[model samples]
Target: MALMQSKSKILIAGGGIAGLATALTLHRLGLKSITVLEQANSLRLTGACLTIWDNGWRALDAMGVGDTLRREHTQLQRIDTLSTTSGLTKCIDLQHHEMRLVQRKKLLVALAQALPSNTIRFGLKISAIHQRQDRSSIVTLEDGTQISPKVIIGCDGVNSTVAKWLGFGPPNLAGRSVFQGLGNFPQGHHFQPKTLEIWGNGITAAFGPCNETDVFWYLSRKSLSSDAEISYNSTILQEKARHLAEDLGNKEMVEVIKRSTPNSLSLTSMKYRYLWPFIAGKAQKGNVTVVGDAMHPMTPELGQGGALALEDSVTLGKCLAEVDLEKPAEIEAALKKYVEHRKGRAFEIGVQSSVSGILQSGSWWLPKLIRDKVVFNRLSPKMLHHTGYDCGPLQILS
Candidate 1:
C-alpha cells in the first residue's frame, strides 16, 4: 500500500540456511544493519537432517556455533558403500575429521539464535528487484512496499526470483528425485556412528545415525516421468518409500524406513545450474548478487549444498568487510573479488557432483564395475579431502 524504508544496509532474500548464515556472518563482522526476509510464515522446521563435513564445521566455527552443534550430533568415523548389483562393498576411514550429523531445524535455529533479535522478518516475500546505476538496489515486496538498501544478496534457493532478475536461468534437473525421512527411535536404536549407502540398479539409498536415538535416511531413483509429481501425503509417501526399500532388498534399510514416522517423509527433485557461463558472463549486476543454491545449485551427491552455502556466507562477509560500501565502485570491486574467489571452487564441486551422480546411479555393467572397484574404494576419499577447504577468517573492521 505504501513504501517502507529500511534502516538496514544489506537486504538478504530467502531466510533459509544461507540467508540466515549471511546475516550472522555480517553481524559478527560488526555490520549490524542486516535484514533477512523469508516468505514462509516462520522458520521451516520440516527438512530431515544434514551431514556436515570438516569444511562445513570450519564455517560454523567461524560463526561461533560449531561447539553447540557438536554437542547434539553423532560424529562419523567412516563411510561404507555397498553395491547390490555387484555385491561389492568398501569402507573409507574419515580419520580424525569432524563429520557430524545434525537435524536441519536445529542447525537453522542455532544460526538464527546467534544473530541479534528481530534481524529476520518472516512472511516478507520479495516480488522484484531493481539496481540503480550507482550500485544500490531497490527491493519491492509482494505487498507493494519498496525499500532501498545498500546491497541485495540473493540466497533464495534453486527457483530464485533474484537469480532470474539477475539473468541466471532456472537450474537443470538431474533426471532423478529423492525421498527423505527421519527415523526416530525414542527408546534408542543400535546403529554405529558410520554413514552407510547401498547402490542398486537405477536406485540408491543411504542412512546414518544423527544421534543415539534418531537416524536420517534417503532413497533416490530415476523419475517416473520428466516432470514427476511429488506426493506430500505423509502416509502415502512413507508407503512408497517402504516399498522402494523392500524392492532394493536391503533389510537394514527397510527397517530404518519402517521406523520413520509417516509425517516426516519428504520428496524433492534434484536440480543444478552450471557455474561457468554464469560466472564468465555476469554474477553481479550492480550491487545485487546471489549465493548458495541461488548461484550454484548442484546435485547432492557430495552433500556440499548446505556446506557451500555456509562457506559463501563467511567468504562474502570477509570480502564486503574489506570495502567501503558507501562507494559504488568499491562495492562492485568487492563483489568481483567474491566471485573470483568462489566461482572456481563452486563450479568444480558442481561438476564433480553431477558426474558422480551419473556414475553412482548408473545401471550399466561397466560403469557399475568401475564404480565399485575404483571410484568408491580409491577415488572417493581423495575427493572427500578436496572438499575440505577453509573459507578463511571473517574479519571485523575497527
Candidate 2:
C-alpha cells in the first residue's frame, strides 16, 4: 500500500467512549477534518453496563445524545445495599438524581452515528508515534501507512500506547478483579428500576436494570491471582462469577450470573493511576495528549469511569474550540488548558474512587465497619455532589 498522508487537522486514537465523544464534540463545534482511528474492526460492545449520572447526561445532552439514550434505559430510582455477613440491608434514595444504566453498545452507536460516516477508521492499529519539533505527531499504523496530524488525542483506554509515549507509567492494579456481564430475561425481570448491591467478606456485587428484560451485573473481590493469571475464557469467567454469586448466597444474583450470555461475560483486573503523576507530571507533550482512561483510570466503585470520560471530552473540546489550531504553540496551549482543567477534577474523583474500592474490598474489621456503617448512607450524597458537577456546554467556533 502507498504511504497515506492524512490531511485531517486532528487525529484521535481508540474510538471508544472518550474518542467518539471528543470527535462528536468537535463536530458539534463546527470543527471539521477530525479523524478517529479505532483499533478494533468494529465497536467493542460486550462490556458491562455503565451507570451514567446527571453530569454524564449533561455532557451527552450537550453532544445531542442525552434524550436519545434516556428513552432506551430506565432511570434508576434508588440504591439498595445488603450485607451478606451482617444480613443487613439499607436503601439510598436517588429519586432526584438523573441516573441510568446504559448499555455500552447503545452509547457508542449513538455517538458514532452522530458523527459523519467517514469520521472513524476502524481496524487500523498504531504501531508507533513520533513527535515532531513543530509539536505535530506522526502516527504509524501497523500496516505501515503514516499519518501526520496537527493534533493527536489519545483516548485509547488504560493500555494506551499514546499515553505511554507521553511518558505515563502503567496503570496500577487495584489489587482487585471484577467479573461483569449482562443478564437477559427475555420474558421480563419484574424488578423495580433500582441498583441492588451486596457486600461483605471482601466482595462487592451489584446489579441494576437496563430495561425490563436486560440486567447488568458485576462482582468484585480481592484479586485471587496476578492480573496475567486471570482467565479470559468466557466459560471460565462465567463459571467463576456464578460460583462467587452462590457463595454470597444471593439466589437472584446467582440466577442473573447464570442467565448471562457467554459473550457478555468478562473478567479483568481493575486499574487506576495515582493523582500525583497527573498533578506533578505532564499530561500533554507537544500537540499530543491523553484523555479518559488513558489519562485517569479509576475504580468503578464510584461508577464515574464513563461519566468522567464524557466530562473530559466536553472540557477538551471547549478548550480547543477557543484556540487557533493553525499555530503549533496555540494547539499545545489548548491541550495544556484542557489538562489543567481536568487534572484537579480527575484527582478529586480518583481519590474518592480509590478509597471506595479499598473500603469495598478490605477484609479488615475497621474497613468493614466503615463500609457498612459509614459508606451506605453517606455514599449517595457524596456521589450526588460529584455527579452534580457540569462540564458546561459546547460552543460553535468560527
Candidate 3:
C-alpha cells in the first residue's frame, strides 16, 4: 500500500447540493485540496423553487451563503390548506419558524459563487473509480485522465454513476410519481408565501411562493403503470397539469397552467434508499462517503434533502478538524465514524418522509379531513418538531 502526505485530499462527484456542501465543508476545515468534478460544462440551475427552513438556512449561513440566500428568498408569508371542492380556506400557518422560498437555480448559483474557481471541473464526467489498498480512490474522468485522491465523496444524486460503478444503482420505483411545475397567476397567489398543502377527497394540492409573481406547485398520485418517457421542452406537460387543477381553484389557475412554458420538469417520487453503510461491494472507504440524496434518496415529503446534505458536510468537516488525515487509515476511520453517526438519523428521516408522503396522499373526503384537522393544526407540539430542526455543522460521533 502507498500513501500521500497531504493533510486531507478529497474528490467529490456531482455538483448538486450534497457535493457542493461537502466541498464547502472540506474548505472550512482548512482542507484546500478538494476537487469537484461535475458532468455539466457549467452548473445550470433552472427557475425551480426550493425551501430553506431554519436548518437549511443555518447550513447556508455556516457556509457563508446566508446573505446570498436571504437575498434570493421570498420571505414566507404563510402555509395553509384550502378545499377546492368547497372553495373554502380552512387553516393557515404563516411561518412556524421563518422559512424562505427561493428558486432552485438561484440557490445553486449562490453556492457556486461561494466556492473557489477551478475547484469544480465543468463537463468532466466520471467514467470509473478504482479503489486501492492505500484507501485512496483514483477517479477516471471521461478524458481518460485519472486523478487520485485520499477519498471520494458521492453526491451525484439518485441516478448516481459513481454509486453504479461501485456496485450500486437507483432503488426500485416506490409506486408513486410526482408532477412539478411553476405557473404565473395573474389573479395573484391565493395561498400565502408559506407552503400550502390543500386536502381534497382522494387528492390534494400543495402550493407555495416561489417568488413574488410565481408559485412552485407539485401534485402526486398513483402511477397507472410503467410506460415510456417523454421530453418536457414542449407544451404537453402543461396540458396534462391543467386537468389536475381544473377541479379546484378557479379559471385563474387554469389560465396559469395554459401559459406554463415547456421548461417544467416532472419527478417520479416513489423510489428511495437509505445510507445504510458505505461499504458498497468494491468501494474504497477513506475520507470518502456519500451525502444527501445520493446517500439517502427519498420522497420529498420531508423537504430535507438539501438541509441534510448541509448538515452532513458541516459535521464531517468538523470531524476532520480533530482527526489526523495524514494517515489514510484515519480518513477511512472517519468515514466509518460518519456512517455510524448519521445512518440511523438519516434513515429515520427518509422512512418518516416516505410514510408522511403516503399519509398526506391518502384517499377519501373524511380521512383527509381528519388528518388535516389533526396534523395541520400549527399550534401542536408535534408541529413544532416538524418545522424546527437543528442548524448544524453537527459534531460527528467518533
Candidate 4:
C-alpha cells in the first residue's frame, strides 16, 4: 500500500518514543506522509525512571517543547554518590547539572497526544523488509500486507526484526538485567527524598523524584541467567530485595522493594553493534537505516539510550528531508553525510554506557575506587562531548 502522493512516503516501524518522535520531527520538516506500524494494540513503555540530561533537554528544545517536559518533571539538581554500607554521603557536591527525570508512561502519553490519531497504525507487526538495489525498500507486516516506502526506519528497538531482515541481527548481550520499580512514600515514615545515586562496592543504585509524591528507582546486576529466563516470581523478586537491602542501606530502597508488587518491576539488559559507518570493521546498510536500539543500543549506565535515539531520529529526518526524493544517489549522498556526522559519536556513547555499567556492576575494590575517586573526580560536565556539543543537523538539500 502506498500513500498515493509523490510527497515521499515513509514507513516508520515501531511507535515507541523513538519512532513517534521521528515521525513528529519529520512532519515538522514538512515531510507529511508517514505510517507508523506498532506491534502492540496499545503503547507499552517499560515503567521506570528516565533521566533526560541537559544534552537531551537541549535537543527537545530544538523539537520545540523541552519546557513542556520540564514543567511536568522534577528538576534534578544533585546526584550524591553514597557509600555502600551505612549509606554515608561520599560525594556530596558534584555540581548538580540540569537534568529532568520523568516517568516513562507520562512521556509516552505526551508523544501520543501530540501526533494525529490516524498516523499511528496499531497492531501492525513488521515481519520483514525487502531492500532493493535501487535504494528503495518495501516493508512487510506479519499479516502479509506490503508497503513500498521511499524510506524505512527500523525503530522497533532491541529485538528488531527490521534489522535482521536487512541482514543485521541482534548485537552481543551485555549479561545484565536492569530491574526497575515505582512506588509512593511509605506511610508513617518520611522517605529520605533526594535525586540521589548510591554506589555500592560492586553495584550502584539510583532513586529520584518522579513527580512530587511518587518515586522511581532502578538497578542493574550481572544476571546469572539470560534475561529471557529470569523468573519474575514474587518470592524470587523478594529474595532480590533481601539481597539488595543490605547494599542499598536506605529507607526508600527497602520500602520500595518491599512495597512494590512483582508485576510492577521492569527488568532488561543493554546491547549494541560495533560501529561500522564512522569506524571500520562494523556493518551498516544504507536506505534500510536503523535508529535507537536497532542501530546503536546502549546500557542504562549513562541513561543515553533514549537520548541517542531522539538525536538519531531528528538527524535522520533532517538529512532525508534535505535530499532529492527523485534521485537515488542524491538521497544516498545525504544519508552518507548523516552517517559521517553521527556514526562515530553514537558508538562512543555506546562505549561510555558500557564503561558506566562495568563500574556499577563490578565488585572489585581497586577498580571501584578508580571509578569513584580517580574517574569521578576527573569527570566534568564540560568533558561530555556527545551531550554538550551536537551539530543540529546538515541542511544539504540544496
Task: For candidate 2, write residues 56-96 as lDDT tens digits.
Answer: 99999999999999999999989988887667787878877
lDDT of 4: 0.68
Which segments of candidate 2 are over 4 A away from where they belong? 1-6, 226-230, 377-383, 396-398
- Candidate 2, residue 53: CA error in Å? 0.6
Task: Give each model's whole-structure lDDT.
Answer: 0.84, 0.86, 0.65, 0.68
Best by lDDT: 2
Screening candidate 3 with a backbone cut-off below 3 angstroms (N, C-alpha, C), the clashing residue pairs are 40-123, 48-104, 78-94, 78-194
Clashes of 1: 0
Candidate 1 lDDT trough over 10 residues, lowest sum: 223-232
Judge candidate 1 at residue 141 and give its lDDT. 94
TM for candidate 2 is: 0.95
- Put down candidate 1 lDDT per residue, 1-398, tens digits, no spaces: 23226487788999999999888898989885788999998998787877788889999989888899898898988889888877888887788677777788889999999988888898898899877766678889998889887788999999998989988877888888888998989999889999898888888889999998888999988876632455667776777888989988878778888888766678888899967666684677888888899989999888888899999999889888888878878877888888788888888889888888888888878778778777866745766775569997666442
Clashing pairs in 4: none
The residue-by-residue lDDT of candidate 3 on 192-297, one tens digit each, is 5666666555455676666666777766666645312433433555556577767655455566566554465454546786444443322325545677766777
TM-scores for candidates 1 onward, in order: 0.95, 0.95, 0.84, 0.87
Judge candidate 4 at residue 86 and give its lDDT. Answer: 32
Instruction: Report the CA-based lDDT of candidate 3 relative to the real structure.
Output: 0.65
**Distance from true location, Cα of 165 in model 3, Å:** 5.1
CA lDDT, candidate 1, residue 187: 92
